[model samples]
Target chain A: MIRRLLLQHQRLWLLTIAVLGALFGLLLLLGALQLYFDFRSVLTGRSDLSQAQYIVVNKEVSTMNTFLGQKGFSTTEIAELKAVKGIRDVGALTGCRFDVNVTMGGGAIEGVPGMYSDFFFEAAPEAFLDVQSDRWRWQEGDSVVPLIVPKDFLRLYNFVYAPSQGLPQVTEEMLMLVPFNIVIKSKNGNVLYKGRLAGFSERINSILAPKNFVDWSNENYGPAVTAANEVKFLPSRIILQCDDASSPELAEFMSEKGYQTNSENLKNSRLSSLLRVIMNVCVGIGGLIIVLALLIFLLYTQLLISRSSYELQTLIRIGYNPKMLTARYMRYYGLIYLGILIVVVAVLWIGKSLFAGFMDEKGFPVPDGVSMPVVLLGVGFMVLFLVVNFFTVWLGLRKLAMPR
Target chain B: MQLNFRNVLPIPLADTPLPPGSLWKSDTSFESQARCLVQAPSGTGKTTIISLLYGLRADYEGQLLFDNQDTRMFSVDQWTEIRKQKLAIVFQDLRLFPQLTALENIQLKNELTKTLNEGRIREMAEQLGIAHKLEAPCGKLSLGQQQRIAIIRALAQPFELILLDEPFSHLDEANIRKAAELIMQSCTANGAGLLLTSLGGNTHFDFTQHLTI
Candidate 1:
């Protein structure tokens, strides 16, 4: 009965406009949140292959450096790069100072004919390697050295080199079974050890051996360090583990130092940052719309109370409790807010499902539903709005219902 | 509850010369269930006294007390409780919701108090001869009819005191007699006190006391 009396003077059009505005605002907020969640999951889920968080950086080789034979980084330069913002950890890519030769076939392998090749090998810290294998460890007495070849190198061999040379393509399983001899030759002495394929790396491009193995080999077989030949052992490439590969600070520091890395990785970082900025802007606009909608709703409630002020006063004069009247208005507006939030959540869920379905068709599977945080956020927004508007209504009615 | 007026002079009448028998600026007490007739000429604060006692106005010089408790000290909730269960009034201008039908106006009070059932309310309306007009909006009714609705609304609530300020100004003598009989019966049934104000003429109901305000 109190609701009926108070609602008598309510302008329907104003209520309709307020409800529509609130719906539009909340839907935009929840929709943007849902999209952000989906994009984040997709990015992180495929981060190993596509989003290279570990970037291998090297000083750009120049004619001046070539003439001076000063391509490797100095200790001071490596420390400075380690101190760069956003770089979490830095490890050098150590190159072999000794000669490496791989000899396959002639009883070394079961079926292949005799083949030999000179190969350059590099090793990095285990933390920076994308591939993990128990066989990657090398002890001093172990004669079999495990090697991780780049995935791109195998692709090039199978797709281009082998096809052109009319050679049979080898699968990774087949290659892993092949054990060949690695003959290391240096001025100190010569050593022959068996080598086996450990794994293929998607992140690092270099043919990788274990850091322990490289350190041992360099200490035992390499020449004594001289002023002119010292650069041969210095690290020319460094792998960086960064917190955000897309941080502009990392790119800026790299560019300022005349360093080079995979441009695609930086481009992917820029894309991620761009998505973050767009999401923030969308959320800002959504928040602004919600605030404006709440203001409109408050104004509408005030107008309704003011127009019905006489009736409310009369009711109070006849002994109607002000708190009871305030509760009535709260229940009315609370239900409206709840309905609006439920509709917004439903629409966002359906929209996300449709988008997920579309992405699935494109071979990119996104999660199918509104994320839990967004739903909780929506509920929080509804409660906040209800508290604000209900307080306004309570204040207005209490003032009007006061004795003159 | 007893109403105690101690040298109470409404702010508007602070400078006015008081008649010899006037209750203004005088220590007076009306105990519980004491039916008093407050007769005065026009512009003599008859409505103001009713307003002060009903807590509609606090702009007075002296203290007005309900059972020795200062009325000025009452909070809004306290006043609401007093109005809901202790005191009821028929305002000089019938303060009915114009948009509501006469029965709804009466039921608005009845719903809150729950003192009188619908049958009793309709019976009271029939006795006051406004039964047929109960379905009509109070705004569309005659002043006499609205006055009768206001009276029924006041009697529908439980109260220790019921104030009527010029309640029958628009009613004919015949309707006024019927309203007075109904008012007397409702007061007798509830064992309530009556504070009826008039502009000095023939007044109905034998009162326990009369005061010139």
Candidate 2:
């Protein structure tokens, strides 16, 4: 009887649904925003070390080595740095055992300096390097050596070196066009090789050559490097490619070990943490809105019950327990919650679809399904609404039965 | 149930005109197989007394004991049991759920126990002159006809006591007697006590005892 009679308040119920659905939509939007950005940052490598999962570390050059060059990490120091937590893999930087110069046809170009102008050549483990192309490897019979020049080198040449020398500045494409001869001279022998630029490295700061080329150059012409440059045979810089570049623990360990990394590495760690804090705040606000919506829904329900208090009192006097009457109310409010759940789930599905499509367009990994945390949030929201409404109706009915 | 009232007067009014029975005094115990009239003029809180007896109100002074147990100490569950099994009422306002049909209003009480079948309910409705009006919404019915429906609704449940507060206020004397006959048979067959409150002589049932409050 109470169920049928209370149907007069059609507008009240519609208002309840409208308000709840709007709030629920906002919550889903916030959740989708958080998920999309977090996914984008990780997939595109904006979050951690420019998507390479590797940070370049070395010993900062002291004033004593400033005129010469940076000092190298010894093998013992490299082993100790490998023990740092979160350091997945570490590779050493191999310096040229002998000084080398590049010239076209064994002579300096008209405007471009080549022969007798020394340049550093370094090699690192191919797995840890930024350039992934097979062009970086070489064979013994192969005369052509693949090279990876650092982006900072071109920038320095364009902005600083070319203007002062009154020489024509070359673009990356023009530089890749030149097939040059690398001349290595030592007491053992002189080796000549053909080489071209493979790519540019953002994480590594020096020109890179094939490990085969560097080994051959060192074995043949190593004795030519005088004691003035470097007396040691070990590498000059070390690279540690970590799995999690955003970890502050890695930074603390690096500081403790007197190791140095580039400014961009530290900047990326801060960006990752900032994104995390924003995501957390969004989730917190979404949670708070859900709680407030529940409160409003409770008040709305009690108002309806209060309007029907006289009818409830009549039912109670006729030997109808108040809880029995309120139990009928549970079905009524339960259906409302079910309706809200359907709306939120549908909207969330659509939102996730749209986001997933965007991710595919951006070349990010498309998720197999909507993330588990968002789905769990949707379910938790529904359960909480139903539970709160159930108790609200029960308490409202009991209050109606109380003497006024 | 033995209902005892010790100095059970209602709280005095602030400044409004007080009715003759405002300062009521009553000591009573009646068996289930009896009929009683609580006589009072209008504005005398006769509905208040019914509400207190039904365990709906507890603001009045003094103790209202039922079967030697104070109604004050009764839990909500106890009150529900008492109302379902030991007490029922036809309020002065004839508090029917207006959206339900007359038959539905009556069966809302009967559904708790299924004490009275639909056929028996229709028979009693015919006797009280509301048989033809059973299908109409209670809010659409005449007040006199709704009163007959309220009387039938209260009597449809199993109870040890039935309290009627001015139930016949809108009924003619002939219709009131017809409704009263149905109530008497229903209460006597269930072995329940009958207590009716009225402003004047609208009922003529043989009283087991009369209390002037």
Q: Estimate, for each residue in A1-404, the C-alpha lDDT of model 2 and write its tens digit.
A: 56666645536665566466536654654564547455645543563333436777877667877886556776678888788777778898787777677777344445545444566789887886777675667877888888999998888888899899887888987877777878776665677778888888887887888776787777777764566654366576778777666665676677777777774555455555666667667766766676667777777777767777677667776667877777777777667666766666666667768877887888775554455555566667667777887788778777767754
What TM-score does candidate 2 get on C-alpha atoms?
A: 0.64
**Would you estimate the TM-scores of all the predictions?**
0.72, 0.64
Of candidate 2 chain A, the 10-residue stretch with the lowest lDDT total is A43-52
Instruction: State residue A48's C-alpha deviation in candidate 2, in Å.
Output: 16
Q: For candidate 1, lDDT tens digit of each residue in B1-213?
A: 989999999988978988897899899998759888888888888999898898888788898989899989887789889888888889999898888899898888988868888888889999988899989988999998999999999988878889989999999999999999998888888788888899866467888988887
Interface RMSD of 1: 1.7
Clashing pairs in 2: A72-A236
Off by over 4 Å in 1: A28-244, A247-265, A272-288, B6-9, B18-27, B209-212
Give the top-scoring candidate (DockQ): 1
TM-score of chain A of each: 0.74, 0.57
> Would you give the TM-score of chain B in model 2?
0.91
Number of the top candidate by TM-score? 1
- Each candidate's fnat: 0.64, 0.61
